[model samples]
Target: MLPFQLAEIVNQGKLVSDEIIINLLSRRLEEGEEKGELGFILDGFPRTMRQAEILEGVTNIDLVINLKLREEALVARCLGRRMCSQCGENFNVASIDIEGENGGAPMYLPPLLPPPQCESKLITRADDTEEVVKNRLRVYHDLTEPVEGFYKARQKLLEFNIPGGISESWRKLLEALNIEDSDNMRSAAA
Candidate 1:
């Protein structure tokens, strides 16, 4: 577990030290291996060049999917995020509708409105403020962006632009991965 101090720093939108993350990751990977798991998907790891190098030494990564979103949309979405204090469920109040320019694809993400019961209980996350979200984006550009080039050079990077809301994006993502949409598969997974 991360020390409380370091965890606090992370909650402030700062990147933690590579050594700490690497050690934690190594332990998890070992556990996964011991469980006879064939593969794993890491959502947000290898955020820095050092972490990427270390991960390369430990495993064979087949592909990296980079989901691209407009900065404005990203900021708005982050800031609009809320959690229900009573039930601990997450929701988004941001209704983003951005028109594309210069032949770019338009983006639209409707708000994930909460039920009536949880409406009054919604609370903004401390880190979802504009300042913190912007800081996180800056940190990503400085520290994590390089990892994209590292994977690109290895022909393992797939840059995917998020077209719209969750359903549309999910369909596009499935298509990108050449995964056919099947009711049985979705129900079984659920």
Candidate 2:
């Protein structure tokens, strides 16, 4: 399922059935496999043990990158995220400036300025509220965290709790995956 589809389900404070999630993922995987795709960076699949078991039947997964973050940080991060209504591009509150304080409150000015070539405004997803984010994290810890143990038992989990932001994390990920910065780095990663 697309992020928006999953977001809608999650925003309603409900979970999509594992079977449906697995089926959607399987279809996408099948298509990628047909095209000779060697590796995939699955964002949020196999959240449950059953889903992980089903995945074993599909393809050989070498590594599972688990990014461990504090609950408070996760809540803040989710609350900060905004997306372009037109193109679905993501922007974060940390990167954007918010004017006013106290009761006056929250006037956003994205550092990207005018978002060149795009006419539509960026908006927060309905589910990105603090309460919903906390609930989602609760669900993750209760159900999805077990998947970490599943991979750990198989010696396939590479867990990290890094303090640095995206660039540092991306560098670490490329190192873990053993991907090199060759002339075709962009195409190879794609």
Candidate 3:
């Protein structure tokens, strides 16, 4: 698996430790810069303030979008996630329960939402379990809060609160980012 191979490389270790990925990324940027493309979007990378500084030195981040949802809300939303076994659709248990999933405590178990598309194959990730998700969130808060602050101090951050529902939340998110049309997003994703 890709993760397994990454583990081998990580375990083998090198003189460069935490910044190894950044070094590789800078190499990638150099390659992309040679092309006519505008630039690259680095998501889930540069997690630390140091990494942010390193990135700032290389290029300007036009917008740093932050989803400002309460931790309890996030925990509920994340802990209640259920996905189709064959297809990769995320259904929020805190809001709309899927039709099939039976995970989490009785108080927390969310109803499964059937696959959005008729394509039948859906699966939940192993790490989506409650304990794993809770720990993941704790780590996320610890790591990402600083990254958020890093941008906040530079006034490069744009935050959008999660609205009352998914539909509204997504609409607000796009509005915060100034995305005027969904067609462009769908086409880009496609």
Candidate 4:
């Protein structure tokens, strides 16, 4: 998922099933259409060529948002990721909101056992490592390429260089959708 924030919460830990993805997306689209809204924020769906075809034919894909991040940056960013010991919370030593007990960030503990000292809410999976992240990113890119082309051909794909990273990327995304403030967006979220 380009927006890894949302789909990363799946309990299956990235072992996503096509049936589950399609079913959820279909349901959301159906609910939206019934209400005459016709909108949804699909994160990390349509992962395969077949899945992309299914999405194109099913909801008709009004639009697609793609973020382009450099491979090195993605690798570096992913490799440096450290998850919380208690709650499966993710953090980057290099990114914002870093916290530590001894005035420094603590080591991530996998779900096997809770840290006696940390007491985090969720367990950091074994897969939250550089090797795993790089592998995941590679798989993500492979899956994303065809979908990008598919939507591009339909004039539904929008790509942002997002060279300035997430905050700038989000600002541009909201602006592109003509969403000036949170009020209008609140309706969908609520």
Candidate 5:
């Protein structure tokens, strides 16, 4: 677990050292193994080549999903993100609508609106500012993007392009994972 000080730094869009992340992950994975969990999923991890090398030393990763989105849309979405100060629930106020260019698929992700009570308590993250988001994107392109190639070389990466809002993209994601959507299953049974 990151100390409160390190967590504060992370909240400001700064990355902690690879040693800190690797140590935390090692302990968590060990605990999961002790419990005999079938598997685990990590989001937004192995952000550096060093971290990937360390992970490879410990366990065999079966698959890695790389979700792709346009940088413009990503910036807008990040800027629109909000959290309730009281309940800490997340929401997005941005409604993205980007036109398809050069045969690329058009993208639209509607904002995740909050309830009436949460609306009054909404707070933007410090790191969600346009400047900070852009900086983080720059850092990702410089440091983390290469991790995609690392997984690709191992034949373990699945590039998934998010085509639209949750409903549309989620269905496509289920298809990619070869998993049946529960809603479809229920409708068929009915």
Candidate 6:
């Protein structure tokens, strides 16, 4: 099972000990290795130096994408974010264009939204509130920021600006990974 799945199990009604977290994560890493998986992405794990050390023992990590954003923008982006209730599609309210508005209003869907429709209203996540987001950011700075330096010293960090937009950053990531043509990168695999 994936580490996140193990995390969900650990998070159910109790706090998971660091030993348990490390064991579960190590097992998942081993499973991925046995299956010959490449370019594994571990989102929101290894928040501590110990965890990073354990990961170093398990396998080599190729790239680390550190998204840099201003604290104000981080809060605003989290506040303006919305998700599809049915399909779990994420969209930012700021990125969507409103129809017949004077450019200050936020809309759930962009003007000239394509069919077929989602039907469900885009809803804000419970954890997206100001207080919760601020706390999360605080925790990140306290626990996770050190990991960036850890990887940076190893020459594996790629810091990207969020205001540059995801698509542009995505292309930069492709370049970082030495992927010349992202379109053909997948087809070549198949």
State which candidate has the highest lDDT: 1
What is the descending lDDT order? Answer: 1, 5, 2, 6, 3, 4
List TM-score per model, in order: 0.91, 0.74, 0.65, 0.63, 0.93, 0.68
Distance (Å) between predicted and true CA of 65, model 2? 1.0
Task: Give the distance in Å from residue 148's predicted Cα in candidate 1 to where it truly belongs.
Answer: 1.2
What is the lDDT of every predicted structure here? 0.90, 0.73, 0.64, 0.63, 0.89, 0.67
Give candidate 4's total backbone clashes: 7
Q: What is the lDDT of residue 90 in candidate 2?
A: 78
In terms of lDDT, which candidate is stronger, 1 or 3?
1
lDDT of residue 134 for candidate 4: 69
Per-residue lDDT tens digits for candidate 3, residues 1-190, read 3666665543343112446767788888888888867967787666667778788887778778776655565666766666765555666545532232265221223344664572355455455556766666676677778999888888988876654565666676778776776686788899
Minimum summed lDDT over a 10-residue window in model 2 is located at 105-114
Return the lDDT, model 6, position 76. 70
- The C-alpha RMSD in Å for every predicted model, in order, reads 2.4, 7.5, 7.9, 9.9, 1.6, 7.0
Better of 3 and 4 by lDDT: 3
Clashing pairs in 5: none
Tens digits of per-residue lDDT for model 6, 20-127: 777777889788889997757877666777788888887778877786766665677777777777777776765432333375333222222222455356777666
| Sort order, TM-score high to low | 5, 1, 2, 6, 3, 4
Task: Give the Cα error of residue 78 in candidate 4, in Å.
Answer: 2.0
Runs in model 2 with CA error above 4 Å? Answer: 1-8, 95-120, 183-190
TM-score, cand. 2 vs. native: 0.74
| Residue-wise C-alpha lDDT for candidate 5, range 57-100, written one tens digit per residue | 98889999989888999999999999999999999999999989
Measured on C-alpha atoms, candidate 1 has an lDDT of 0.90
Better of 1 and 5 by TM-score: 5
Query: Cα deviation of 160 in candidate 6 (Å)?
Result: 2.4
